[model samples]
Target chain A: MRNHNVTIGIFIVSGLALFTLVLFTIGNEHKAFSPHVDLHTEFANISGLTKGSDVQVAGFDAGEIADIEVPKSPSGRFRLVLRIDQRLNPLVRTDSLVTVDSEGIVGDKFVQIHGGSANAREAAASTTLPSKEPLSLADLLESSNDLINGANGTMKGVQGKLDGTLDAATKTINNANDLIVGIKQGKGTVGMLLRDQTTATEIQQAVANGEQATVSVKQASASLKHASGQADALVSDFASRGLGGKVDQTLLSARGAAGNLDSISGQLHQTMTEALGEDGRGVDAGGNIQQSLSNLTETTGNMAADTEALKHEFFFKGFFKHRGYYSLADLDPTTYRNDRVFTNPDNGRAWLEAARLFEQTSNGQERLTTEGKLQIEEAIAELGDGALNGPLVIEGYSSQSDSGTQLAASHSRALLVLHYIHARYQVDLRNIGAVALRNTPPPGVHKETWDGVCIMALKASS
Target chain B: MIGIFDFVGAVGLFGLRVIGSVFRIPFELEQIWRHIGEAGVRSLALVLSAGLALGVVMTLHTRGALVMFGATAMIPKLQSLGFFVEIGPLVAALLVAGRVGAGNGAVLADMRATEQIDAIEALSMDSFKFLVVPRVVACVIALPLLTVFMDFCGILGGYLSEYTLSHISLHLYLTRAFQGMQWSNFVPPTLKALVFGFIIGTISCFFGYTTNEGAEGVGRAATSSVVVSSLLIILADVILVKIIFLTFPGSAT
Candidate 1:
């Protein structure tokens, strides 16, 4: 019986001890026996932060939220009372930033305390730390939506500009089509320059004439220069032989004759001025006859003296007499004399006559006739010459429709011509190119009257 | 209808009579100690086994559910909360009602059938005081201690199970287990265990003390004690939990 009592007492004591251990562990978690400092902070939106939520210092758990109160002084904010470990109180400074944080995207909320600088004063017990509200998922989503909307608007603006550019490009392509048609039909100056043999011949003749005129001017300038040199030598010889006086006498006689002639000319000018009298204004509007007669006689005398000095000084005479190479005669303005035309073989290779090669329809649908094959074969053989040996460009034409359907139909027609030529001549396929021109036909021909692929040969541009 | 009223009256009188005899002089300390040994010491191994089994089962079940929420790491905390607030006390009480209540009912019913209780009464002794009072007092005292033992064993069992699967150390598991617990979580349920002990003792003693049909009545008494005590304990728990929540709002969460 005593043993039974002892065993029972042992069990009871053990049970009590176990109970105390559990209670103590629970108390430790609650900080019931630990020395702690109470700190306070205010947040506008704690975001469901509750009492007993962890208070962390620099990501390490230092304490827990002890209480949460809504003071009447601040309407929207809740003041959180934090119980921090007393040992960590020195690390918590006045300038430390406190923020409400969540463990993960959807995890429990906690209060995070970022330590202040070393020089900052320690925050006293019950001091309120500054707090920043935690970011909410809704706010993040709204900002992301704004960014996406901005990017979407920018992309839409770029698409609008791209559409505008495409429209302009289409217009430019249509203008090019019109220009190609005009060239094919020999309708404009470019066409005339290409297809009109007479104009080409005239251009060649003009170029030849310019070359001949250049040669003639060169010869004439040379002759004049040689003649001037001879004159200079003769004058120098006369001066060196002391025969300058005789030459001067001769020039004096010439100058006297010129002076008499100048006086007579002045009298003739007076007679004319008197016949055409200025009655309305009573002014000599035509001439001052007596001053003119005296001035002419003095100029003739000065010229006679100057010429006598020039005869004595041959260097001045030679300088005055030398003529330059360029002259009015050098320009052959009427027509060039040389008629040798340098015709580019490549120029004649464009726009072959395909009347026999394709049957024309008023609706602008072209098909190869039986005779058309023969004509194509002949044209191919002709183009086989070394001068025109290059790519055979078949430009198909469609008018009245700019739709892709018409464009595709024109392409089919050009492809038919390309295949026909390829099969018959065994020509290298690389030397053939096909194209479709929409809303255009050979220039100067109406859409109702024209239908054919203009078989033009391409020669590499030099 | 008369039997129903008689049964209710008898149960009410039995409860009142037990209360009246609680503070009588010349207390039966020796008998009380013996009953305590019988109720608490003899039943300790059973309680420990039940608690450990329940803890391991609960840990595995909670892990199954909590894993879906990616909260498998909260197993220790969840187990602590479950055992302290609801499982530990109730389980320990039910276990006590089965072992102690049946033992007391069967022994007292056998004594009455053989006229042992009457023999004591004829000697001018308080038979209810001698037999029922000590047993009731012993149950009341031992239940809380047993509940604490159950709690300790349960937490240890949960830690073992969690450690097996998650490899968490004993220290870490204990820390995590008790971190969310408060005094209120531990107190209210333990106090409610006292009420459970009282219910089991009084109900079983009432059935056992009134035995009249002879040997067959002993079996009925033992069976009835277990059934009645278990039902009443559950019903009382519902009310006690409500009161506890109202009294300590934090523990209610």
Candidate 2:
């Protein structure tokens, strides 16, 4: 029984030994008992990296860290050693970058590798690849400190600028407000200009006063103009009537007494001898007296006869010369004055009336005079209707220059001459408005030096 | 000094018996078959239990180590590499050495103390065939099957480990196991286990059949078998790894 037990024990032990072997052998092909490769990476600061952490390429997990071996150098810096799978070695390129990151905000630290340029070579095994230094706590604190300092300085400057600007702005606003109040209170020039009401009252009073003065001026001007017209007509009419009646009587009487004036001159010579008969020498003295008396009386008689002859020739000879010879040429003044019709070579009728008036009234015609005014009106009307497009002359004369002083005689004469024509006679310039504005420059010469006359030529504006 | 001699004498006697047992094994195979049935079938529960337990324990324990490295998905690799090269041979050899080696030694001690082997020798039938050969042959055959069974159990253990400790499902584990890697990874370990089985069985038989110092001698033989077998297993693993790693590292890879 013991021997049998021994054999049983041996078989059991052998089977058990085989069992143990099976476990290991099965694990072997599966790499459970196989050796694994170890690779490492290092960084200046791991940023809370721990062992057995994942290593990723791009986003995929290519391997893990088997161990973290920190080899201390003489300088007391630890060179980190990480064991990684050999399979993942090729994923690490020459320029691949690694960053320390966490799964989430609080997850474990991992090394994330960024794929490098396509042309780069893969990192080899057992190689210590370069690593980027992660931002340390000191760096963060330093940057934050700089930011705070900058912010503080900016705030200080802003505060100071704001203080100065606010004070100046407030003062300026107060001054503006004071100026506005002053204007409301009617102070200074602009304040009064903007707010004063007394100016309006004064202006209304001045307007009423001006109206009264205008009414008086209107009455005075009307009275003066009426008096001037009637007086001028009466004076001119009487002069014309008296001169005509008296001159006619004298001409008729002289024509009738021509023989008697011849007989009286012989009687006056015989009378001179009778007054000398009182003395024997009376005959010689009387003869001398009579001869002297007779010579004086005879000279006076001859002058009277010559004056009558000149009058007859002037009136009758001009009438006869123009009546007998009418041609389109320049004629003598007396003849031209007698005829109002002068013909030009262009077959146009030139009014001899204009020439006659120019000669007759060369001393400036008093258009306001009342003689033959109807005739003047008819001539003006005819001239207008003809639309001759010819120049008409309007003139003015200033009886006074300066303050009755010849000191500025020439200057005032020119100026006053233009002023009178503009103010009085130059009215109705639509028909005839020309002025030969003149100054008494030389002793015998009155030259119209200024001809600044505006001519209104009518045309349609369309 | 005595201890050294005793060990020397023990190894010497063990060698002689092993040679003698080999010559006698074929004739007594029928009787050995009976022993095999008795020892193997009777100890099936224990063998399977111990084998499976060792396999599972080793797989789970080592798989856990691999897991911390995020290598849990490689549980089958763990199982294969471990079972084939180191796990299958060494574990099986040690267990058999401890169990069968002690059993044989005790049996020989009993025969010696009771004069059973002496009596058999006097009958002119080879006592080596009757006592040593049957036991040796029994162990040699049984240990290998046990190792194979253990290999299976180890794979199962790896699957269970991945299931419990990892997110891997049993189906996936088996799918990965049955992948060509299983048969391929199996060839080396099981082959090695055959050698381990022979080594352990022959050593146990040698130590047991050569018992000399009576009851004490049997105890000594049992202890020696275990020690020698364990040592041989280790030595064999080292040499095998060198040859494999050095010559065909690619294969292991």
Candidate 3:
């Protein structure tokens, strides 16, 4: 009986101890005995934020959701009451922002509170905070689609003009490719200069002959000085002694011969100038005065072909008073070459230097130059506004800048050239296309003849 | 079906009679003390062992599930919630029904079968009040206490199992165990034990007090006591849980 009483006592003692432990632990978790403050906020959508979700203040765990209430009114806003630790009450303020957030993408929802300004009053119990609504994936996707559609429309408009420009570029490239093939086969003047050994030897001989002519000119000037001195001495001797009359007559005849040579050189220059129409008044078989000038320029370029050309090249070009007509082709074989434009056939092509056309050095708006006006007139007449072939392409190139930036700048230059051509010739703008290129030449292009320039090229419609 | 209805009706009356005699028993001090020893002290080993085993098993199961979500730290909280809500009350009631209810029923049934109950009546003592009331009162008092004991033991068992896998401090584990629990969580499930005790006591007494088949009836009474009490306790739990949720809305979370 004593043992039974002891057993009962032990049972009662253990049971009460466990009961107390449970109450204490549970009470602590609930903050039942701790001091706390109540905070409130209203949300249009709770997004499954249930009770016990953590309430954080500036990313720190400050509290937990105590209760959620759906008001009696039909507006359907939910009022959430939170139990926060007393220590965190100072951080909460009347103007603080509250938002519902989640742990990760798919984790539990929680209330996040951002502290108000320093001057804002500390929050009282049950202080209300402004709530922010979270953005859904559907909203993000809809905005993205709107952006994509806008870009697609702009790209479509650009693609049409790009296709036309691309076709002209392809044909021009094919012509240049054929030229390269001919040059490689030693079929043209340029090819002969590169590959024909006899032509090379002849060029060496011509250079030698030019050097000899320079030496002869120097010797003749020395001889003229010597003859003048000798004439002075002989005249003195004739006056003083009246001796050697044959020698005196011979000196006078030599002087007469020098005068005749000078006269003959003058006559030769006058005749050549008249033939070439240096005065811009002579017309060739084409009945175009400028056509005659172009032919003369071409003839001047091939100075190795004729005796008159050699004479003009070696002596007359140096002595000529004309400033503009004295081209560098007279002296250097490579200078002032017209091979960059291999064909004319009515439809003309030319590369106008960007620097010569524009006052401003780099990019942007361009001011016209004196040479630019002359070149534009020539290009417009040559293009014929597609009367001979198809559209005229004013392709702009810049090898020194970024492709996109350079292309855009090149496009601006092309547009300027296009406007000039249109204003002068009343050419249809539709029959002109502008192209921009980077450091690389266009398709099938072997070389770039003009860098930082607008190349006005013509192509047949086919 | 008729016998079942008759049995249910008789048990209902017996429950009422126990309630009726509870206040008027003149505080039979010795009998109450002896019954407390029999019902509570005697049942300690079984309750503690079962509670500990249950706690270990539940912890293992919850760990396996929560681990997939990287929520292994939630083991303690889940164990506490499981014990307080379902495991502690139900297990305590069932254990008592098996040990205390069967013992009371078989003892009373044997006395009735052998005419000892009649002899007590002939001696001018109230057999209903003396034999039935103390046992019913003892059960009503002891079950809740034993449930508390079981809940604590189960938490310890869970901690022991958790410790083997990961060394969580005792203080931290206990704190996490009670992280979301409340007085409401503790109250309803503990109060439900009162209903459980009444069901076990009344059903067992009803069977034992009216024993009819002599020695054979004693065995049937003990068997029926465990079976009927367990079924009624489970049925009552369903209703209790609903009432708990309605009365205390956020306690479930």
Candidate 4:
């Protein structure tokens, strides 16, 4: 009987103990036995956060949400009561931000409390913390979709403008190229002056006539000087001879010769001035030769302006872009450095050092030496026989202390190299261009600064 | 149908008499203690074994489903919640009805068939108090305690099964198991076992005490006790669970 009682007692006690253990463990999870404080926060959207969802304080597991109060109106926010452990109370300051967060992409939602700054006071019980409503996935995706659509629209518009600009540029270059080719073929008046044998002979003959006229004028001036000397001698002789008849005749002859010489000299001076402008008044001041040359220059400039205007015209825009030609003069240093034509991976480059390639003239101007011409020929040869098929750009670089000096030096070097290449090799002028890049070389050239020209030949990928 | 109603009416009258006799008597402490040992201590092994077996089976079943959702971590919680809220109390009651209820009925019916109750009544003792009331009270006191044991044992069984599969630590398993639990989830279901205990005790005792047959009736009484008590417990469970949910709505979670 005692044994039976003991077994029953043990059974009852153990069962009750297990029950107590379960209750205590659950109570601990709920913070029922621990000292805690309640905090309040309101949100426009709870985002599936339920009561008893874990509350983390600055990423630390602190407590859980105790209650949620639904608002009476649709516009009103849901008020939440958070029960946080007293040990973490100091971390819950008045300025702490409360937000609803999820455990994972598809996991349960929880309340996240951000720790406030040290300057903020500890939040008292029932104090409402600042809240930010949870952002829904739908809203985020919608906003991103709108942003992508807007960006796509902007890119389309920009692409359209760029295509139009490129087309116009290509058309202008092709037209300019055609015009130059026409002139080279002697198809027009300017072409005739440059290429016609008859016109050339006439120009040579006119030059000879001007030379002869100058020599005649010089002879007239010499005669006048000689006449002045003779008058002085005649006056002396007249005084000595006491106004004899022979002295009077000699004076009249000298006077007649002096007057005739003066007339000849005045006519020569007027003829010279009309043909070859006035002395020290500049070539454009007044003269038939100066005026004709000025008119030609003006006409060429107008033609160039009209060609340049084709780049902006709607009709020729697409044609220009298709040709892929760009004006070297229009490219600044930055643009040249970034331009794909000269920076192409397939393009071959030859670096000619300024000191090796050029020498200073007696007048302090830089010009390419004989060795420089040889170096350019060798660089072109290194690019293979196919170098002449595509465009070649002469990239001029000069490391001068001043920007203006750098630009001038680099431009002079590039122009000299360009002229030498054209004149020496008979290379098509339309196939080559020169650009002054100041001190900076194009990207991928492995140089921080350069003081020379780089002959870049666009080579087709083989 | 008429016979079924007549049987029910007789059982109701017998239950009323038992209730009245329970208050009117000199308290049957010794008998209650002896019956408690018989009903609770002796039944402990069966309850634990069944609890453990059920736990393992439940875990095995739920593990597959939870794994499909990538929620295998919720297996322990599901096991605990399953045992605490419904399985532990109901299964324990049914087991007790089959074991203790049959034992109580058979024992009482043997004494009645052998004229032991008539001998006790001739000596100026209340036979119902000396016999039926003690057995009923013992059941009432023992059932909830058995339920607690079943609940914990089932959880231990689940942990063992889970540990074999996952090599999960005991502390972590226990923590996760109780993480989603609430006081209402546990207390109300455990307390509902009291109603199940009452039904088991009263029906078993009524069947055993009212039996008029001889030795053959003892077997009939035992069989009737188990069937009636188990059925009543199940029926009572449905009502009690509803009442619990109505009283403590949070337990539904």
Candidate 5:
């Protein structure tokens, strides 16, 4: 009976002790015995946060949610009554932000109170802290879906433009390619120049004649200056001597010298113009030498274009792609606007209005302002971290009345922005290009015309 | 079917008489204590071992599924919750029903077969109060305490299994295990074992004390005790769980 009593006493005591341990451990986790203060917050969406969910202050477990008051209407927020440990009351402040957070990607939701700034006062009990509405997974997915759909539409448009551009580029390359083949067979003017020794000889003679004419014109100009000086001395001497007949003889000789000098200068001018063409006029008014040289220049230009096309062609592109042999320097406005490099769907662009970006100096020259530089910096930031990795183009636009003024203003704006970016960011000059669009915005840029500069960060095709 | 009803009626009448005798004067405190020692202390090792083994198996089973969800940290919590909320009480009752239920039936049936119960009646002592009330009262008092022991042992067993795999600290495991628990969750399920103990003690004692067939009936009484008590405990558990849920709605969490 004594042994039985001892064993039963031990068993019952141990069982009760274990039960008490469980109760206290659970109570400790919940801060049930700790002194606590109630704080309030309201959220438009609780995001499935239940009453008794864990409440954390700056990621430290504090207490559990005491209660949740449902709103009277859909627009009204759900008021949450949070019970926080009094020891952590100092961390809770009037300016502290409250948000709904979770344990992991798909875990239980909890209330998180971000500590307020040190300058703020400690929050009083039952004070309603500002709450940020939680971002639900459904809302996130919906926004992303809309973004993806917009991106898809933009990509489709870019694809259509790219196809058209590629087709045109292909036709241009083929024609140039045909011309190259013709030249190799000795069919074009360039071929004739290469094959006909007589034409080459004549070009050499014309160049020699031009050189001689230039020398003769220099000699004639020196003689006219000398003759004028002599005439001035003779008139002075005649005035001093009062010799009328001597003045008449000297004047006649000066006239004859002036006539000869004029004749020589005229002949030189005519000969130079006939060989090299007029100052602004092209090969049409020029002699055969000028026309032949023009044809030679055109042929070389076609060859250069063909070589560039070959570098991008499927067969040879692999060689140049990774070697960094690709150049954006020679990109013209037409090609740039059509090329996938600038028009790729992944490219980022920021448009700053001209009025905001530029200020006119006293000399009537427009320059980038301090605010304009800040705006540019913000625009670059908006393009994101990868903005500097690829080719960047500054597209200048102007709404000036005349085409000449528009072109000048647009080009000036683009050049100013380009210089600022290069100096401020130290971006590689080779990786950046500038174009004066002269009032026309790029296709599908959401505007028909814009008086602004568009900074385009063109990502390389994947 | 009529025989089943008759047996149920007899059990109900026997239970009411035991309840009425429980509040009467000259209570069997010594006998209740002795029976508590037999039913609870003697059965402690079996309940604990079974609880520990079940805990190990439950952890191993749930660990794989929880790991796939990247929720392996929930293993300790799941273990404790499972044992406390349902498994500990149910398993403890069934084990007691198997052990003490058979013993109670066989001992009393032997006494009845040999006319010891008749000898007690002849001496002017109430045979039901002397032989049956103490055993039923002991069961009602001891089962819940045994369940508490079972729950803790199960949690410790889970920790052992978890520690081997993760080398988790005991503090962190215990913290996580009890982090989501509440008084309502623990108290209601544990108290429900009282009903289980009553079913086991009453059914077994009824079989033993009411046996009329002499020596041949002892084996039959013992078998019926184990079988009927086990079945009634299971049925009572289902209803008791629902009642607990209704009474304490927060425990559902």
Candidate 6:
């Protein structure tokens, strides 16, 4: 062979000699090679511990594990063995905890000690490390399950509310649908509008016309508002003159016109009656009625037949008569129209009211005291007036009575308010008697607790 | 079996016969030193390569089991445990035992077959004193030294795989590897290596020195020496473990 013989003598001797050398060299790593102490501990579970493990102080390696023994379950406690290097004894405290941990995943297990305390004293050699209970996987899963359950409960609550709301909304929508269906089948007023074709057509046409009329009404209202403003301005202008003077002037002119018209119309009427009233009053009495009508028309050609329209229109009847202070007798004595024309058919009176009121203050001809007379006269002399209310009391109570005596005095001091109808600004007195009544209960009701019924007895009006 | 016992007793007696041959060491050392060029130093590469490769295989085998739970990260620790605690020492010890056991047995057996041992006996010199003790002591000493060398190279091999495959920084790997170790991890192996070398050397030398006639005896001696040494190594390991680990397992680190 090219190679020298491979001797077992060379092989075996070389292998052993060098191994012994390195053993004592790396021995410096542990405190045992020098002078050191040892500590021990036991626990219920060692979990897969092996030798050569570390004792950690606050996650830092402080010592090596020195020994392990599975002692006979000492005093009923599970057997465990530990040996901690003594040089690191300063790091262990009485309150320190010891636990077993795997060096790596699925690796050999070792005992890890978490040591230290601010107030705890230094632990002695052979000190037992306290055991700690760690949170288990089961605990984690339970809490996670609880959170999921809570989330599920929240979703269920929201689902229930949504379901109720949807049901109510669906029911409401169904009712609305039924209403629409009823209308299509022609029930009630709404159904009539939808189902009656003639009524619908007429209403449609009316609505069109009404829409047009609405425009005219709006324009009229606008014009009337402007004219009313102008009227107000004119009235304001005339206020200094007092409307009584104009009313007096109008009454005089109407009297003069009536006088002139009465004499001429009377004469004409007599002549017509003697000429045609008797002889041509009937068809047989007349000589050729057509010839007479023609002759009548020829003679009256200078006259207007339109004068008859004046009677129907009340052109001869002044609107002021019913509302006027003067009666027909107060007209100028020499002037008159037909006497019956000024009469009111409803009252069969020639005037709205005929009365005399006289007041005297310290005068023998007086029938009333001035204040009483003024009050009554104001109430009575108003044109077209009637009583609004019989009378009401205005009682004033003094503050002194609250402390002194009876539960307040009731008395009457004045009449109630008079109301009127504004018929186109003509204030016609209308019968009315309504008053807003308020009765204040006495003050100072003491505080009361619930669970009791409190009754109040009402007093009839005295 | 009785004859076998007598034969073993005769061999033990022959090996002790050479204890007085201490004066022959200088020449023997010279020869050993000369052969060191070939056996130990020359074959150092093969030894180192085989040791390193064995370390890698050991590291991977242990790590693969641990990695089911993703403990490959702890391979340096495991490799350290295997090498320093068991594999590193055992592999190197067995290698030396095989390599030295067969060689010693063959040489002695060949010398007997070639009539060289008889010639030494005729020369009025104690053949056992001249030949057996030097080789036995040499093997006892040399095998452990070789094992130590193998251990160092195996550690390096473990580190290479760690650095190459797992990317453990040298600083971190060295630190963790050294962390779980104690004097016991190293001392027990080296001491055991010494015992192992003695067993291998004495048995193989004994087998060959008293070997039956012919080349067949030489072959049988060499083969039997390897087998016997291997079995003795396992038995010594078991006893040593009880002494080291069982006696003081926790503090052994």
- Candidate 2, what DockQ? 0.05
Q: Work out how many backbone clashes candidate 6 has.
A: 27
If both were scored by TM-score, which would come out higher, candidate 5 or candidate 6? 5
Task: Please say which candidate is ahead in TM-score: 1 or 5.
Answer: 1
Per-residue accuracy of model 6 over B1-253 as CA lDDT, tens digit each: 9987986687567656544454553446644444344334544565688888987777767766766777666677667666666775577667766787788889999999999988999998767755676677666655556666777777788888767777878878776776757676677766676677677778888888989668999999999989887887888888887788765665353
Q: Ten residues in a row with the worst lDDT in model 2 chain A? A: A453-462
TM-score of chain A of each: 0.38, 0.33, 0.38, 0.35, 0.39, 0.30
> Across residues B1-253, which tens digit of lDDT does each residue of candidate 3 receive?
9988987788888888888888885766678778878888888889999999999998988898788877776788889888988899999999999998898889899999999999999999988888888888788777888899888789999999999889989988987787656777787888788888888777788778878678899999999988988899899889988989988776665
Most accurate candidate by DockQ: 5
lDDT of 6 by residue, A1-462 (tens): 223334544454555445544555466455446655565667655554555566565666565666666667555433344445555667778777877665554445556677678689887766666775434446769999999999999999999999999998998897687668757877546776777899989999999999999999999999999999999998888886688788889999999999999999999999777766445446443656778899888777645444444334575535433332223212321221123222112211111110122233364322322233334334434422322221111111222234322112111101111121111122222321121111221222222211111111111110
Taking the tens digit of each residue's C-alpha lDDT, what string does model 5 give over A1-462? Answer: 788799888987888888788788878888899999999999999998877789999999999889999999988999999999999999998999999998787467899999999999999999999999999888999999999999999999999999999998998897687668756765545765665789889989999999999988998889999999999999898788889877689999999999999999999999886866544543345466677999999999999999899888999897766554646556577766676556666778999999999999999999987578779989988998877777888999999999999999998999899887876566889988789889987665677898979999876553
Q: Score the docking of each candidate (DockQ).
A: 0.34, 0.05, 0.34, 0.34, 0.37, 0.25
Best by lDDT: 5
lDDT of 3: 0.76
TM-score of chain B of each: 0.96, 0.79, 0.96, 0.96, 0.98, 0.84
- lDDT for position A389 in model 3: 41
Q: What is residue B176's positional error in candidate 1, in angstroms?
A: 1.4
The C-alpha stretches of model 3 lying farther than 4 A from their native spots are: A49-69, A101-110, A115-119, A134-462
Candidate 1 vs candidate 5, DockQ winner: 5
In model 5, residue pairs whose N, Cα or C atoms come closer than 3 Å (at least 3 residues apart or on different chains), thus clashing, are: none
RMSD of each: 22.5, 37.2, 20.4, 27.2, 26.3, 26.4
The TM-score of candidate 4's chain A against the true chain A comes to: 0.35
lDDT of 5 by residue, B1-253 (tens): 9999999999999999989999986688989999999999999999999999998889999999899989988888899999999999999999999999999999999999999999999999998899899999999989999999899889989999999999999989988898757777788888888888998899999999999788779999999999999999999888888888788766765
Q: Give a tens-digit lDDT track for model 4, residues A236-285.
A: 88778788887679999999999999999999999887866555665445
What local lDDT score does residue A332 receive in model 2, on the 0 to 100 scale? 38
